[model samples]
Target: MEEMIKLNSDISVFLYDVLTKRQEKNAKYSLRAFARDLGISPGRVSELLHGRRLPGRDLILRIADALKLSPLETEGLFRLVHRQKLVQKENGGARQLLADEYAMVADLECYGLLMLMETEGFKSDIEWIARRLNVTALRVQSILERLERLNLIRSRYGVYERLQHRVTSTHDTPSDVLKESHANVMKHAMEALYNVDLNLRDITSITIPADPDKLSQAKEEIRLFRRKMAKIMGSGKTREVYNLNIQLVPITK
Candidate 1:
């Protein structure tokens, strides 16, 4: 049996190495079995190994998990895949995120799913997540799959975990998608205002004259404030999840 060697930047070679290592342990191992274990079709796996196709980020993560790669190896694989994506983009072959993908980023429930995973009482059950996020179990199921495809979350042995602490909508996201997300958040805030106990929630606002020229600086300050509050609230014995929404918009323009 050979020890795992240093993986090259080429995914094809890395995959070949994985296959060879498995064959060393079990001479009966077949390509179909390999593909099955990796959760990809045999033809697609062949294309990847033959360098006819590059693995997408989702496929890369799936392969990494199937191979049970070490943390360092997983990071290396991601770097390689990202470089490949850059090359594809430069070659005008890059696939942009589909509208559905953008919608996932713009879904406020998706953000709630991530945050809920951090709470002390978090459960991976769809019903539990649905209840916690105020969404239907079906919606929770859809968001879980979408988040996994985005590599923001992963499930292993029936336990789901957040790969990222937070995610922001990409700058390229359409205005309507962003607006939909913001509207959802605002709706939640409104509900909490009347339904939640005053001691358990805080909703405060202030309006002041502002300089439009310094709007960028003001945005940066807000970003920092959000991070500061996240750190403060995330510390010590977290039992619940909360969202902090801040709005900075002109009333008259």
Candidate 2:
């Protein structure tokens, strides 16, 4: 119904956001240029990015191919869109976990399959998932065992499943807090590293007016900066910032 379509729209927007971020990081072409290259209107591309339209399967595949996204990424996007549609049709009572949550579950090997099983009321057990994933029963058992150990999942009647109590409470947490937390973590980590690099370069710069004494002072400052940077990088807890982009750069003097 209409709600289903709206859910589809929301899911489409989420996919668009992921793809757009990837494109922004990797693509050199402007959005208009890229749209032209893909034989679509710029406005249409904008609509897709803004989640005003639900892209068809064919278009989704085409866009994935055009963006050079990996099969995993493409499948993830498709799954999100499909789940959104299902949730919308089901009265929108379920909470929608963001990509980070998906990533976390993926790390535990309990993302896609767990969500599907939960939604479909299937018993999350080795046998059930072994058949679904077309994997060996032993492998599925190992995964379920690990999940149970982490307390992320539990077992009932030999069926393994995510703990219902641990589900993301998106309804209780304000969206702004979630967004701000993510942004702050990503920003601070990036800025910290960037500042370190800049300071190193400043220390290395040898201008005509730079006296020997000033150069020595700069070297000491650089040493302090390097130590501070090392400390920041070594802090395991502080590195929890969600940064997907590679910031490695070759400095040219």
- Candidate 2 C-alpha lDDT tens digits along 7-95: 33244344344444556687764667767755677887766543445567987787767666677767765776676556544533333
- lDDT of each structure? 0.74, 0.51
Q: For this target, which candidate reaches the highest lDDT against the unseen true structure?
A: 1
- Ten contiguous residues with the weakest lDDT in model 2: 239-248
User: Which residue pairs in candidate 1 have backbone atoms (N, alpha carbon, C) closer than 3 angstroms, thus clashing?
Assistant: none
TM-score of model 2 (CA atoms):
0.30
Per-residue CA lDDT of model 1 for 1-253, tens digit only, reads 0133243434665676677678889989988999999999999997776555888778877988888888777777878767656655553442233355668667677777877888897888999888877789999999889877655566756999764443343346688887888898999999999999999999998999888999999998998898799889999988888889999999987
Model 1 residue 190 lDDT score: 99
Clashes of 1: 0
Residue 180 local lDDT, model 2: 57
What's the CA error at residue 41 for candidate 1, in Å? Answer: 27
Candidate with best TM-score: 1
